[model samples]
Target: MPSKSSSHSWHVFTATQDPHHHHHHHDQLSYELPYTMEICMTELDPVLAGKFFRRSGDEKSGHSAGKEMTELTGINEINKEAFICDFAFDPCGYSMNGMDGELYSTIHVTPEDGYSYASFECAGLVNNDDDDDIVHVLRKVVQIFRPGTMSVSITTCSEYNNEVWRKVAGAVEPLGMKCRSCAVDQFPAIGSVVFQTFTPLRWKNASK
Candidate 1:
């Protein structure tokens, strides 16, 4: 078992509207970006996972629990303009959805023995300068779950390039994880996809 590990995957797809349709009505302006990220993790620390559990006898709704977790996890701090909707599962789990202007982000946690898992996903418009934002978000997520292993998938139009994966690797490696492998491929007309895997340094040493 790797002490810390991660992977990233990317995809690209066509846009339904003209690329120059930014002048459309605000409501018609979907926040859908040219890319998407699906990051997954496992082997979460029990102490950190426990934070997802609702207090005993507390009958708050899932939305309420989500709000509390979001605040506690500093998800609210990521983008103050984003409207958040969240839910808390019984015993130990949490999920949240956030929309900031046109961007969307979501998080889910399943902290159970034998099947511990968590995921973070988001979509937004990005320019060359947005790499720092990815780093910040990725780091915050790792802090939340402290997973021993993780995988990240990024889907984006071919025109967008693949620099984001390097930033992703930079964000998590300092936390004691190391990148083990990276694979890239094109999805026909969809675009390009990149998959990167990471493992904890401790695990690497043990395997040797």
Candidate 2:
């Protein structure tokens, strides 16, 4: 039986630090201005997981398989400048990393029956004026796994905008998952964190 613990989750965080601070004069100056988003999915649909398998005689290389999935999922089009490095595992699994200048995106999958799981993560500038980009990306990620349950966490500086989560919820709920809980907290000087949980309508009905 598939574990009920299986679920998907997302986390996004943004922060800025002074590169020239005297306290860290010896440290290299590195800063990530873009927000980060992580989405995890578990208890994957067997039919969908089958798509990640590599056939015989095919190049037995992870990079090749990763590249194939990247192209198949249209991830390459997400950022024109993004350079991808991917891998495929024996039996069934895939992983990829996308680099676009300073920003990065990564994906990993485990299609096994007992512990099926997948994750998609990316870093990019936040556009408060429009969230369509994120919504589109997330929609695609969810489509890939069609998970039964999911959770999302967003972290950003104290001044971080709250509208992003609303948009995230909006993007996910339409796919049959409904938000069940939302929690907010602070991380001292780091930023604020918001964690939300969701479950598919069918799952909720089953539990009831």
Candidate 3:
């Protein structure tokens, strides 16, 4: 993103015109309070990343592979109580969605050699617990991927905005990940949007 751009950047995330927001499921989320999470991870552990690749060439369908991966990756351990549906792509890749009542959590992985990436997100995950719940969920994801670098973005409705946005660093730093950058912005009905980037302590001095 450039410091000075044409009118393109602002239009990029505007919900009203965003094609994703126009999608059926997203379009239906008219919750009075909605908290959305986005996490991008890169440089995953080779040993763990390799597990996402298919074992038997064409022996299994996508759903079968995904089910194996869900247990293989301990994704089921993330939330023992929730029922999960997972699918693995033919050659390599995995995705799953877990639903708990009306709320949901999802994970996607592209566990390739040089460009491994994974993400986890939950929708309006916690109606309460403010930052505590956010910390718990994200930390679990960090343990799974153990990415060398990661960035997180959180969007929440006005009600929990104040309590949630400030906790990103506190949730991740104890695990040896250091918050490298933080930026914030407000959206029309989305309330607060906070973005933060992190690197492990081995990468740099976490202290200011």
Clashing pairs in 2: 8-151, 10-153, 62-87, 62-88
- lDDT of each residue in 1-208, candidate 2, tens digit only: 1122434233434354743322212233443233667666778878888778878777657777777877775667666588888787876688888898888888888888878888777877755455666787777777777876666665554444366568778998898877777666655444566666667877678878
Candidate 3 local Cα displacement, residue 39, angstroms: 0.7
By lDDT, who's the top model here? 3
Off by over 4 Å in 2: 1-33, 77-80
Q: What is the lDDT of residue 133 in candidate 1?
A: 65
Summarize candidate 1's per-residue lDDT along 1-208 as a digit string, tens digits. 1212223443444554444433222243333335677778888878887778788988888788778878876778766778888888876689888998778998888988667889889875654545656677778878888888777767666645467668778989998877776666655444666667666789889989
Sum up the clashes in candidate 1. Answer: 22
TM value for model 1: 0.79
Local accuracy of candidate 3 as per-residue lDDT tens digits, 19-80: 33321123333334457787888899899888899986569888888988889888887777
TM-scores of the candidates in the order shown: 0.79, 0.77, 0.77
Instruction: Choose 2 or 3, whichever is better by lDDT.
Output: 3
In terms of TM-score, the best-performing candidate is: 1
Each candidate's lDDT (Cα)?
0.72, 0.68, 0.74
